[model samples]
Target: MSERFLTHQVENQPPSLLPYDAFSTDLPLREALAREGGGWAQAQVQAYGVLAGGEMMALGVQANENRPTFKPVDHYGHRIDEVEFHPAYHRLMELGTQHGVSGFAWRHADSEGAHVARAALMYLHYQADQGTSCPLTMTYACVPALQQAPELARDWLPRIVSTDYDGSHRLAWLKAGNTIGMGMTEKQGGSDVRSNTTRATPIGDGLYELVGHKWFFSAPMCDAFLVLAQAEAGLTCFLLPRFAPDGSLNAVRIQRLKNKLGDWSNASSEVEFQGAVAWRVGDEGRGVATILQMVALTRQDCLIGSAALMRQALVQAWHHVRHRRAFGRTLSEQPLMRNVIADLALESEAATALTFRVARAIDAGAFDEGEAALARVITALGKYWVCKRATPFVNEAQECLGGIGYVEDSPLPRLLRQAPLNSIWEGSGNIQCLDVLRALQREPACRAAYFRELLAARGGHVLLDAEILRLETLLGGDPTQLEGQSRLLAERMTLALQAALLIRHGDAAIADSFCQSRLGHQHGLAFGTLPAAAPTAHLLERAWPA
Candidate 1:
């Protein structure tokens, strides 16, 4: 009966990808974790991988399909300034918190590779749902900023690190756990927080009342936000909570939830602070410096988030090609298609390798000043390059699936929409490049750390050696003249870093393809345009073993 009614049967369509082991099957991720000293967290990573690839993914669809809604007032006309989310969104947050996406690094601060392990956790959770990652990332990032004020840290650290997820809108002190948000940019200044007009008036006991607007108030539902405003001295950092000390709702007004390009499951708002009581976190006029600690960690997640998108999109495309057939063979068996998949695989693995290496650097930085400098410079350049590549990379993976990939039913479109957000959110490409330049020009230790890394991988590949030399030559130029070419400089440094990681720690096939296609510029401008010597079959198998 069904056959008679059907116009045509679905034949070549591949089944949806789910219930797979996101961690176990990822050879590069597993290898990176082991190499980066996160081996102690293997079992935990594996468990979260299963959840991320399975039920959490299903919940991600629900959360995004039913986006968060702005509930500015209660039924009785009380201004609530709240954002209402789908149940699935809360569930995703719960799973993420339980798995330490919000607090792993701090919780295991003394452990080796704690940040690396935490980075891996966020990487997996991001694949499940990109939107929910906003709050998760901020909660983890807020720790260092809070520590600037011992009183604030003492009051907030426990809740921030709590494994439990409390979505209650009550006072943070009353909750078992809490999430933190950030509001830095104003309508007048995007990244230039020093231009922020938000004003903070002094009150007793080191508290102040903030009155101003934030054009991009991220994750407004969080219990509190770390915001910037002008104090008597100058621009200052403050912790503004939703509820004031006296149990009254702070006058933080949510103007409207941003109708963003993607990240529908999360709520970003335009907010006006009307005498919102806040506590100063650091020295007055050092707001930029104080919040930058949080920004650095968030930028790391931006890299991880972008890399996760590449990997997830690659997995979707790779799964489709293996199952869907055309021209008398599976798409994966076609030579051109194989080249594209392998090229994507190379990009994905290279991104993963570089990100994890940076995470390791972060872990090491906890004890070593040299490593700290390396982490700072690398995070800037890595964030710049990896995030810039995400949109194009996802679109290329989409091309591998042709029209089906463009359709909403496939994950590629969502991935593509989410891709550019990372590049734009924490700081745009130009910002990252400028940061890299600043590091090189002003921070001698940073420059030394960067070069030390490159020299360690010297002679790994001739192309790599040449690329390193070029980077050195570029750096040798007058610092004043490099501003216009900073983007190119950042891109070159990032490619060199990725190539070095792949050559030294990644799979040989993947490394060879990356060095040839990316470093040597031996391939076309698009994915799948690998050189003749590229091992397409081996690369595909290494990406996601048959």
Candidate 2:
């Protein structure tokens, strides 16, 4: 018994590091907020810090850690398309909503950097739990579309801003706070929402009856959904409520919940609307344009989401290596492991900088057309680049822990699964890259804005200077030639912007290393490939103070 009990004793392992003061420990984030004039958002940061660093995160994550179950019929066998969540999911939703993770920025619409502050909040909360952020993201995204219709906006804005998280599937009119879902992709046309087969026939007074199937209807139990369906004019935007104005259930049929590879906390379903009552959001045929208002907001969240994942993964790695020993020495003491940790830290910092920068632009974009255009482009490129980097970054971080990291019980596995969701959501990597090219080609103002951002750091660093030249060359070449190579160009543009930001705001050594390894190609392939001279210990401490 003694020998067996001794065998059960654990060896070196990482301590459970709760995410503490995500806003404070993240120096890059702090600096970015200061630049955006949101340095005063310390209160919000502290609030999130307490929640993320405590049992809230553990309970919230564990609640939905088990995938949601699709409930097609109620106890009495009446047809009811609903999704059941763990109590943890509801609490997280309540907490997130209470804190304006969805509406705080919009509510304080006059603030100098409301959007930046919101971005920061999202980044912190997502690090705590990834799946529950889905509805919060959709709720935030849906506001602009609602505003397109004064009548609708006047009616819904109050509810949208409500911090109360009402999960019941009832008339939104009766709820204190109502969450919204979205359905843009259909089976036949995924991203090409314009090709949707769902049809909307005008009933009366700008309202219509929609009949079509949505390939992916996320957060099915939401109070309402912003959906796209073909009307006589073309693909049009519509708001389909779970209950009619008279409190009758709408004819939305939930087919089945998707068996997704990850993002288990939230429910995503295949749904159909049979003459479902819906009111037009914008004008008929303005579906894509209107939905894009939502898409752009969600895209920024994707950037933040990816950064959160990266940050959490980095923290876990740093925490593990600090305690775990190998070869008679702590892993953090190992030279190669140090390099890998530093590289990951660099990536996380770059992502954070880009996310907040774009958020600042979005806030300014409200009044400045040029800045708004720039935000449009920055978000897409940032989303594509940061999200694409997240999977690999977290993967390497996971590998740092070896076998335990691969197990489902560890946070690393959940993070690894959550990493790709951002890259693939809103738009896929290819779609984002192509969209960036589209923005450049179609919106000259955006292109000019993009150039201005790059030129701000022109001559500060040799690597940035060359990367800027390469970006210009890509733009100057034939459109047809570059269109197929847009991903290549998007990658260059993303790196160039990150390099510039680092040069302007990051530490001299970190910026120098970032440019040298990322821009100058002075490093070898993979995570541990930072040059031997790189200050690995300093990087680790910067990532999370000792």
Candidate 3:
């Protein structure tokens, strides 16, 4: 019956790629986890990987399909600002919290490489959905900022680290767990918090009434937000909760939710604080300093998130090519397609290695001063380079699947939309480059740490060694010219570090290919530009084993 009715058969089309283990299948992530001192968390990460590739994958689609809706008022016209999400989003949040994606590092603070292990978990989850990562990342990053004010930490930190998901619209203290968000940028000042006009007046007892507007109020449904406002002493940091201490709705007016290009499942809003109640989180007039730690942690997440997206996109393209046939052979067997896939794999592996290495530095920062410095400078540059590369990386992956990848049903379009977000979210590329420069200039130890990392693999490859020398010569040049060259410096620094890590820990073929193509500039600008001598077959297998 089907033979007579059918106009064409789907013979060459690839089957769905879900229900696989995102962790076990990802050779780079698996290797990086153990290499970066997250070996102790292998079992936990493996279990979560199953769900990330299975249920969470489906949930991601459902959440995105049914975007969050803003309810600015109750049915009776009571101004009860609430954002409603599909059930899938709540379930995803529940799984994320239950699996310790947001709290693992804090819960295991005493453990060695706790941050690295947590980074691995978050990376896996980000492969499932980028939108959910916002609230989770803020919750994870807020711990250090909250600790700046012991009183606030004592009250909020417990709920933040709790492995419970309380999505109910209520006071945070009334819920078993909590999520935090950020309210920093205004229309007048995007990254420069000093230009903020929001005013905070002290009423009494370390409390302030804030009257200002936030241009980007992230995760409006979050239980609380870390906001920056101008106090009597100047710019200050405050804890603005959903409910005021008097057990009533705060004066936070939800102006409207942003119509974003991506992150469909998350709700970012423009908000107005009309005498909104808040508590100072850190010392007066030190808003930037207080939140800098949180920003740093979030920046680390940005890199990890970008790397995760790259991984998933590569996996999708690899899966498609291996199944879809063209020109009398599977697409994966074609020489040009092989180069593109292998090159994509090399980039993905390099990103994973660099990101996890930074995560280890973050973990070691607790006890090692050099590692702390390395985490500081490398995070900014890594975030800059990795996030900047994601959009192009994902687009290359989409091209592997041709027209189908551009459609909404395929994940490539969604991934491409998400790729540029991390770069823009915490701070744009220029801001990240300037941050790297600031660290290098103000912190001598940071410069030392950066060189130490580069020198570790100095003899690993000649191209890498030459690149390192070039960086040294460039850095030694006129200081006044450094700002103009900051982006170049950031890109080179990241590539050098990635090359070093690969030489030290990655497969020989991958290391050689990366050095020759990326550092030595032997390859062209596009994805399929690896040298003809490169081992494309072996690279693809290592990237995602058959």
Q: Evaluated with lDDT, which candidate comes out highest?
A: 3
Off by over 4 Å in 2: 1-5
lDDT of 2: 0.87
lDDT of 3 by residue, 250-285 (tens): 999999999999999999999999999999988999
lDDT of 3 at 157: 94
Worst lDDT window (10 residues) for model 1? 504-513
How far off is residue 12 in model 3, in Å?
A: 1.1
Model 2 error, position 121 (Å): 0.7
Clashing residue pairs in candidate 2 are none
Q: What TM-score, to 2 decimals, does candidate 3 have?
A: 0.99
Better of 2 and 3 by lDDT: 3
lDDT of 3 at 251: 96
